[model samples]
Target chain A: MKRKISLNPVTRLEGHGKIEIFLDQQGNVANAYLQVPELRGFEKFCEGRPAEEMARIMPRICGVCPEAHHLASVKALDALWQVEPPRPAKLLREIMCCAHFIHSHTAHFYVLAAPDFLLGPDADPARRNILGVVGKVGLETGREILKHRRYAQDIQAIIGGKATHPVTGLPGGLSKGITPGEREEILSKGKSCVEFARASLQIFEDAVLQNKRYLDLITGDVYRLESYSMGLVDDSNRLSFYDGNIRVVDQEGREFAKFAPGDYLQHVAERVEEWTYVKFPYLKNVGWRGFTDGKTSGIYRCGPLARINVTEGMATPAAREAYEKMVDTFGGKPIQATLAYHWARLVELLYAAERLVELAEDDAVLDPNVRALPTAEPGEGVGVVEAPRGTLIHHYRADREGMITGVNLIVGTTGNHAAINLSIRRAAEKLIRNGKVSRELLNMVEMVFRAYDPCLACATHSLPGRTPLEIKIYDSRGNLQERLWQ
Target chain B: MAVKKVVIGLGNPILSDDGFGIFAAREVECRLPAGAPVDVVEASLAGLKLLDFLLGYREAVIIDSVKTGSGRVGEIYCFTPEALRETVRLASVHDLNLATTLELGRMLNLPVPEQVTIFAVEVADNTTFGEGCCREVAAAIPQVAEQVLVHLGIESATG
Candidate 1:
């Protein structure tokens, strides 16, 4: 009789992920499946609504990446109207986008990813958290983190309406313009961010890169997945978060596909599984090769790592140097280590801070000519941006009167859905042995997805749920035998 | 001369019954007197970010949606801060939990309210995406608001 082990962390009533593993007759790990309950009906709910409402409404879908959604929706509106925003508006928009990246990456590195590497992965569960991290780094650093986040959020709030669910983006431009004083404040804060980012990288170096065991873990096999990479890049093949062509690189570090945001339909496709509410997006040309990773497999990774892999180089000088250092550290392009996402995130953080200063220094950012009224008939439009998690695409179709007729969103986490599931399964296969599962093994498996930094709170965004990371195990006959709640 | 008070409504407004908190808070705000010594904030954030809303306030009353699994839909419960012991998981893989955030805030000498009050309304569905609350959850918003007002020592204008 074959046995089955189901780690049902499904106690949280809100939308979350559940993992179930099937065991062979010998009680060895046979296969594992990641089941995610997604918040449904965004597309259906969007129909018949005013297309312009997308800029205002899309952000409300998830508080985590509202800035990404708001900007993408507004850009889509621009394409729909066939009007370009004035240079000042574009500069302001990009500045806000950079701030969004900084605000997001700061929390991610300090609160989530830092603990695993900084305090050691096998550290006591009680001490392995943001509190522990702040405690280890000292009070001043914690204050620094909060203050920098405040700066980033202030910049965002000043330009984008609210820092969380922004409403400033309009069809051809922005609804508001910053005064010279406001611009100066932003510039000053942005300069502080540059210092903070450098200090952060130094912290990463002192905490992880400088530590040999952590470095090995970064370059190790447990989390390594040799998959294709995808992100956005400018004409010069430099990383650009706000705008550019969607670029996909092969597993061997060669250009796989590069196309405009609208051409995303032709290059990528989604695979809907019967077990999970979420859809797995894969490269169309490579075809669906299940959960496997390789050159030929459609499975590809995204977010910070993929963005680093796909782009030729970073835009700003400091970030370019950081990027080169990271690439050199990994012995070249196409880093396959999942733990390297933390390093890539810091590099991008530096880039965003530099970009913020560059944008703020421009007099155009303070120009009052922010809005370019749209006059063209509304139609279909697709907008894409490199969100903190990865590539976030918003495609909308509207009628002549600008009422939305159709909507599609390929979120950042969805891009790496297949790869995330695969990484979890791979770790489980290696760690879990003949009918025995330990706390350490479970955490290692948890760390596999943690590196990807998938925000179920963003993806799910449902309320009335307790905690996350709960596990319930089932025996061969499908009866619950043991449970683990975290 | 009185301590400043804040009423924070948490949860994503676009996700079905999850918006119950926002709706209740909105109702509470609507019923307040012209110069009530309180600040009402509508937020969709949690964890460390949520702490940003609670700073400098002498007292805070948080209204949000919750599912205890054993409770009936539309049930409302008032909870103390100590009741969140089993709550280790955070709103984001990128955030600290309520307890941890408050601890860090006090540790860093950030002005976090000590007199905190939490109220959660039972909901039928939060995973399904739609605007406003659903069914009984929608009906219970007014009552939840009334409960919040009672806790705040304010009488409802309706009754």
Candidate 2:
């Protein structure tokens, strides 16, 4: 008899992604899949709108990472009109982008990921949350976090016009330039961010790394996957959030391909599976080798760990040190431990904070000239940016009058769809055995997905505000055995 | 110190009926008499992002779209933060719902509004991508805005 175990945690107005486990006659796990809800007709929805509206509209697609979408859309606009923004605008954009990184990465670590480690993974389900984290880490830390989060938002709001859904993007430049007072304030906030970032790393070192069990779990084989990695790199191959060529590295950490965003189609292809709404993006040259990993397989990972793995080092001094420490601790290059995503996220956070300060102090940040009138005809363009999750790609083709004709976007989370499925399956296989499923075991499975911080159905901002998961286990005789709701 | 009140409209404006909250907030903002002690703002964000806007206010009236799985197309319900605390569980993805965000604000000793009320409208459409709410939801916007004004003890000038 074949039994299927399904996990569907559906929430009102929010998107639903599920996991299903198939059991064979022996009552052993055979295959598992991560299924996300279908958000239909996004490209069809964009046809005939002014291409420039994408910067404003795309941000609404995902309330969580709107800044990432805004930056990517603006970059695509820059490419579409073939205009280069002045130096001040470029620096200003990068500063805001870095601030966005800080806000997102910090929130993910403290609120979502930290509770698992700090409150103990097997802690009471009721207390295993941000409240639990705040309880243990102290309320002062929470205050500091809130303060820095506000600082990041203030920076973004000052630059992008709003915190969540921004409106400052244009074809050649921002709608406005920074003032001297704003620069001074941003620089001061940036310094404070740097301090907070360092303290965050210290907290991780003390709370997570010092604990033997958590450290072991982080580097353990259950969460490990040997796969290629991809991220954005500047001219010197340093990890860069904005303005860089796309870089891909093999499992051994050798550079595989580095190409401009316009050539993305030639290097990458999306594989649509009948099981899920999310598409699996894979390298075209290596081809799609199923859901498996390794050099021969096209399944590569993105986000913090993948970004760290693919780059030479962080550009900023403090971040470079943090990167070296992490690389050394992990025993070398190509750290396949998926849980290290949290650690790599911290390193990136430090880099972003440092970069924010560096850019604020630069003289050109106060330049009066920000926009250069775009003169090029509307055509096809591609914009790539390293979002908090991973590489965010926005491609658009517009008519001569600048109306959008076609749109294709490979969001950061979608890039890791195949890898996420593989990770879920690997965790399920190891934790679920003999047709038994426990809450603890299920959480372990969830930890794998949580590490990716996958944001399917991200664009919508409905009320009650959360994604839900429901898990149902069936016995080998096709009888329902257990159900877990979260 | 005199208390300040803010009415936050929450939801995406482009996602059909999901925009009711925003529209309602705008209605409240437009119809309020001059020198009213209330400020109206719109945000397409949730969780901690929502808390950022609610900070420094003594009271917050949140207007947003809600789906309860029942067949009410445009019915509106009022709720307190305490009432929501019981139902808002920690999400598997994304940190903090409304209840937790407020809870954390208090725990951190932030000036979270002492009184928090949520005005949720049951809507028919939230997934469809378009501007403006569906007719049923759009009809409730003015009623909801007037209700918010009355809740604040401020008489509507337009009425």
Candidate 3:
């Protein structure tokens, strides 16, 4: 019998997602799909509001990357009014951006990605979490994770105004500057964070890279995606999270395109799929050729792995050294293994931590002058940033009165939508053999999907706390076979 | 001496009825007597993120929106941490669920609250992006808040 298996509420992901696998009559996996929910009408809701309000409202979309939204929105406001922020203000904003990356990437690597690598994907669902990771690693490691997360959060709250939605960004500059006392506190935390990030990478080396089987899982074909990589980089092609020119590299590690944020519409395009509410973002010049991953398909990826592939190297010394070692281990440029995203994320964590320290120690951080008032007529603008998950784009248009008439946001997670689906489909096809289905098998399939660290906060806004996860299986005849709750 | 108790509201204020907690938290703040023994915090996070809000409190109350599917719109349901533990759909999503977060806090030897209470307001809509809640959920905000007040052993300001 040709049967279908539905895994709704794909567990452990930040927002709602589901996967369905269809098996052939021979019982081998035939096809699979990933469906992501939609929050609906964010653009329409932004309409008719004042332009300046976006910086405050945009962060409400996702709890995981609110700082990303806050920074991007304010940058858009800056572009809309044709104003440049002062050096101190830019430093202040970048400091917060660094903290945001450390906070967000730390959570993804520890809470969502590490459990599988540390505890083994086939481990009991109850034990395959941070708790289990703690149990294996020890109490000290758990406290370290919590402590670093707290440090990042504290830095964000200090610069952004609050831990959730920061109120620090103004049109041309920040609302306020930090005091010397605050700088000392932030500098101390930033120094410790650099060490923490270094330890995190070592943890990965000890657990996954040191183990042959785990290393195979990371570099294996089942989790590999040979596609175009997109990221933001500075003049030296160094990975820059806050602001830079958008650069992309093809599967063969060739520079495909590089353009400024204002010209993004010339490079990126979106495709709608019938199965999911989330839109698939692909390279505009390459053209959309469906979910297939190749130089011709136009489907591209952004985020840690893709960012590393697109850039020359890290901006900091420690991260740069680690980055070179990772590239060397993979046999050179453009590591295509999807699971390597976990490794790339750690490299960026260290860079952000080091960057945090650099900014905190700068004399400009304590400058009293922070604002450059906007004087130009506000009409239209686009702002882009490399959020922890991936590249985020915030486009807005307003009238002369500064009232926003329209808005469009291409969030970080959405950039990897096509890649996530392709990875899941490939894993499902390989893992599910003739007439074989078990919890361990399903979890293995999930392990491939989790490598992307997909955050669906942009797509799902529903209260997810109380909904019960249910999985159902049905035969070709449309009769239900079994139902299981996780 | 100030009370070592705090009230925390969790949800996205722009997501239709999901803003119930933020709205109710504001109402609770206004209704409390001058120098009330409790501090009210409105946050839009869950899992380990809540640990920051729960640290140092002897007792804590969490008010958030929920969609049980079986519950009526605007119905205020009092739930223990154990009940939420059973109903958690996304086991490891954005952060740890409340039960796991608290347990982790205790294991980490953090000063997490000893007594925790969760009050969920059944929601009518949570996906739409709007600052205001739907009419039904908005009506229940005051009543659910009153229930929280009663649980906290405070008299209603209406009296």
Winning model by DockQ: 3
By DockQ: ranked, best first: 3, 1, 2
lDDT of 3 by residue, A1-486 (tens): 878888877778877778888888988877788877678788899998999999999988877788999999999999999999999999989999999999988988888899899988877777878888888888998999999999999999999988778998989999988989989989999999999999999999999999999999888787888899999999999999988999999988999999999998899999998877788999989999886888898888899998999999888999999999899989987999989999999999999999999888889899989999999999898989889889999999999999999998898778988888888878877888886888888888888777788887554434455444566777999788888766
List DockQ, one per candidate, in order: 0.51, 0.44, 0.59
Number of colliding residue pairs in each model: 3, 7, 0
Q: Give the CAPRI class of candidate 1.
A: medium
Residue B133 accuracy (lDDT) in model 2: 80
Alpha carbon lDDT of each predicted model: 0.84, 0.86, 0.86
Q: Supply the global lDDT for candidate 1.
A: 0.84
Candidate 1 has a TM-score of 0.96
Q: Which stretches of model 1 miss by more than 4 angstroms?
A: A8-15, A459-469, B87-94, B157-159
Clashes of 1: 3
DockQ of 2: 0.44
- Weakest ten-residue segment in model 3 chain A by summed lDDT: A459-468
Candidate 3 is scored at a TM of: 0.97
